[model samples]
Target: MEPNPDREPGIPTDLLGVARIAGQSLRHIVGAVTKGAVHTATDLVDDIRSGEPISQIFDERVDLFRRAALSALGLTSTETGVPVETKVDAEDLKAMGDAMITEGWDSAQQPRELHPSFVPILHDLTPDEARILRFLAVAGPQPAIDIRTKAPFGIGSQRLADGINMIAAMAGCALPDRDHHYLGNLSRLGLVRFSTEPVADFRRYAFLEAQPPAQAAYRSVKMRAISSYRSIYLTVFGKQFCDACFVLGDYTGGGWAGDDRGDIYLGKGPRLP
Candidate 1:
């Protein structure tokens, strides 16, 4: 839905064919946006005759076109002034399975190089998640930690907080409070992965453990909190998406991410015991 093009990588001449394919897709979108121009004009006449405020009439016209465009693009189920049910029932599943086999057997059909899910995935990602991808692209893997109460022989350890990190602050997300939720959605989309294995540089965890949530967990358990080292990294699919969509500033080979970390995130975690 939004494009982040800060880095100026020139579009390669070899991508003309790719651009051509994109043009075909874009044409359908353009048509959808401008669908029923004549009908819209007639509707505008009716609105004006009904003595509606010119500003209100203009706003309604734009909103009508936007809904029509989205519906026409099949992004919404509203058609014929009725909303279609989107639940995929048994019949839909069987039809989809049959179609998959039919398509698989069709030797005449050429396989597409780019994935069909990319566009829909883009639509699914929020603005904050997009920023997170850009940050991960250059920042490398970031440190994450789970805070839990210490127990004898590691038995019955209660987790106080999990998946805590400074990603939202580092990425400059508008909604920093929702970083965990955003990360969860990104992981669900198969864009990023949360690894139980810590990043190679153990020093990063020192700062993360000092954060208020970890510190509170320690105090709550009377210095009996055990921090589990973890980290977040972009998956192969996520790396491709970031490379194609974002500007990776000061990016080096995938390695220690602390070089870009700021000192202000010490007590800023949202989760607590």
Candidate 2:
């Protein structure tokens, strides 16, 4: 198996830990670029011209940072990737404002806090629930119909609407009677916030914070699985090999056959019949 670099020595092994680092790094980069404290080519020229830090430069923009991260991870077009926007549509912007307004009043003015433990709310979810959570994580406060249709898992369009409802029920979230009921539940959990309206059935959900506990649990599970799988393969082969070795054969041209040879070689190179 590929030695999960994420779990490598000194790396932030957990997904949430990585995210926290990324967020902090991005924020720092933004601050630096904005304050003209970093001497990157783009920032230096802009700073010299403006006689101050350039507030509107690309490096200082969160959107740019998000895009860059997405691109680096090769998830820019996947369900997890953020949508590219040429311009903000007016109706969509208005809907976002309305959703925020509604959310602001409904929560008794308490801003929801996302903790890492909330990751179980997503990780322990069924495929359907995972689908909904993934959609919400990427798109943010969307209508059920929109969430269903836009889910990355290829759940059929006809089933999208009902799937979201089922996920909500499974999550034990109390659905509101209003149109935004599902969203309200998500909001209470601090998973997402409504941000935009449908220019063409377009509702936007903004990711707020990942629950720390949930993320921790997910990382734990992932690590266990990785370790377990590695152990199993090692037991079978009597040696550890990378993901590439298992799939494409080892550098020594030994895989399952090589495994047999390894056993013989380790035990006794050859035998006379």
Candidate 3:
């Protein structure tokens, strides 16, 4: 048996051949051997031809160990842009959290103090919900209410409409019809909430109560409309999120901010529980 002068066993001689094999291997990657193996294979082939240690080629498996080691140490593909992640365990989670805390305590550099959960929260939000949050962030607590019909004995009062507000129209949401659903999602994410108490300006309720949803609820009832008034506003956590993520305008002339960038829009409203 004679070895081909241009080729080796179990290894491709041409770069294309190496890329093809690496592509196939990547598509059918077994147990995540780290990414960007093809480039490593090609470079290694050159190194082998240049009289470098032939055993190095075998040991690295065409840069497999180097990549896998880097991946294991949480280094991503900034150099080559082909990255991978290894399966992490509970201990890994604990270590990451502890490392984050330590990073937070370091006073040398200005670390982004945004909560880690904010990233996932952004993924969970709909565009409409985001608009609503942006609006609430600036507009302050908008009036909302439960429309109910009072009974003679007050025991059989029926709710005509629940959690009605002008957020959809005010926020300029694309789908005003899904306002309730969007509010529900925001509430679920702890971004917004209905306060038990109402806003300082009681006049706001008149405008909200005059809205179509409220009027329809009133029209449906033969009895007088009993408005259970409340105000919807962002929680402190939500305010922080909006501050970091949204570009808001300083509509109110209260002068809360140091610069003309944007005002922190916590209006003159009662604090939430």
- Per-residue CA lDDT of candidate 3, range 81-115, in tens? 34434467666545545543443353532325566
Candidate 1 lDDT tens digits, 123-238: 78999889888888887788999988888988898998998898887888899889989999999999999999887657678888888877877787654778899999999988
TM-score against truth, every candidate:
0.60, 0.17, 0.54
**lDDT accuracy of residue 223 in candidate 1:** 46
Global CA lDDT of candidate 3, please? 0.63
Q: Put the candidates in TM-score order, highest first.
A: 1, 3, 2
lDDT for model 1? 0.63
TM-score of 3: 0.54
